[model samples]
Target: MSSADQSHPSGNKPLGKRARQKIERPRAILAAALDEFMLKGFWAARVEDIAAKVGITKGTVYFYFDTKEKLFAETIRSFSPNLASESEPIDKNRPVREQLTTYLAVLYEAVAINPDAKRVFHLLISEGRHFPELLDQYFAEFLAPALDRITSLITSGIERGELKSTGLASSPEVLIGPAIVANLWGIVFADRHPRDIDAILTTSLDLFFRGLLE
Candidate 1:
């Protein structure tokens, strides 16, 4: 062995190769699983297909994720970028409408702009009862925190005298109802009957501000 090669005891195996392998193997599996899950619904997706997608044998997949269910949960948790962050409180110093608009733009990109994102939500709405744990993970990762942010924004806007009480202020669902509608529309009809997402947001904002503002 050369002097550098002698420094590590793994013969011809490169240094850190094992560590890299450990990380890359699971990641490859997860990436493949995400694609499979997106293409195939959670219930219909197969581990063998995921393994094939990763170019690995079924045994290799089981070594990392004990069951297909665990693999699916891990894949959704890791690869679904929508749940990555808690919603940020709006900038109170700015106009509430402007702040809300900016926040919604970012949120819209994560939920509406990304085609794959709606599939995850569709899975949750349709199959959440079966995979309750994954549903809970989704709520914790995305929905709950985002709802909290909306509630906070509405409360702050009400306090600042910038908004009027429309009886929907207490409910985050009511406050951000348009997002849900937009996401659902995109999921169902965007391919054939494309709609202007920007226009939807703007019109929703206009109607919302009119109702909320004094």
Candidate 2:
């Protein structure tokens, strides 16, 4: 058999066009939904409009996600980081200051620098009251775990005499609040208030670590 024709390594054939389309249909729908949600808040967004963007019928969009609310939730989920899994594994041997700087850099990049994530944040702020369960899901699924990780990292640093034992360790949300604020600034001000996220992160970390380091 020709090398190109032989695909029996895993005893599975390449997916057919129809199969690939079926797999990708949901992702296309979700992307279109996010754009629609961003352009028009949740109340104004229409499933038909999202489906039109995806070149699919409204019923087809419904086939994958039954309701507009489910579609919006899933769209945010698709774009959001799986914080628990995505967090960089801390190197305990490294100085806590270095560890924190590296970790916070990643957090800031994800929350402040990413435009799509910022859009999702804006949507949540503006439209989340309409979907209380969606807000709860975001907190329970993403925010809670991320805060827990920060708290554990701080506690470890304190025990190792690397970080100061302060109220900040107990409330680790403060560590990431500035990143969220920067994200909000982007959403509210757009290009009018141009601030470099890298500079913001560097300065914020420097100030924060000065207070945190033992």
Candidate 3:
């Protein structure tokens, strides 16, 4: 093993028996594609540019992803967390409100810190009007899972009498509504009037729980 590869963060030492570069090439391609797609909207992004970014040929890019649209979709999907798995930290043993606060804190931290993923979300909102397929995939992969988890939490809270009987009981969007607004806030004011994300999230959840809690 080379000295540089010995201390890799992933904890995997160099293996002389296998060609890991072959496995890394697709990841490199996707990384390159994300940069290109974010810089030049999906429609304007070319497979040639993505391939060129990674020093690969356009045909090689197509070998991994059949088309530019699929590449764009996969690039965005790659950055999104699996909300189902993310929500696994929820503790049924704890107070429901406390469980919810911890959940939102983790979720908001993830959304606020990942600027590249936020940009991809902006791409989804802007381009989704024209590309229904991307919209469908995004909803199925990210949105539905998040909503389902939120619904489960809210349902539990209602059953335990920790929360009021309201729309948040049926539609948990009320809980995450600020996250959507915060994404827009970052998109517009991130350069000029950036707010402390932690402060914003704390205050939003504080207010959210106060209004919902019985």
The best candidate in terms of TM-score: 2
| Model 2 TM-score (2 dp) | 0.88
Q: How well is each residue in 35-120 modelled by candidate 2, as lDDT tens digits?
A: 99999888899899998998889999988998888899898888875556546666788887776667777777778888777677
TM-score for each prediction? 0.80, 0.88, 0.82
Candidate 3 per-residue lDDT over residues 119-165, each given as its tens digit: 77777887778778877887887777777777778788888888876
lDDT of 1 by residue, 128-187 (tens): 788998888787877777777777777777788777766655676664566667878887
Residue clash pairs of candidate 3: none
Q: Which 10-residue window in model 1 sums to the lowest lDDT?
A: 1-10
Candidate-wise lDDT, in order: 0.73, 0.80, 0.75
66 Cα displacement, candidate 2 (Å): 1.3
RMSD per candidate (Å) reads 5.6, 3.6, 3.6
Query: How well does candidate 2 match the true structure, expressed as C-alpha RMSD?
Result: 3.6
Off by over 4 Å in 1: 1-15, 81-92
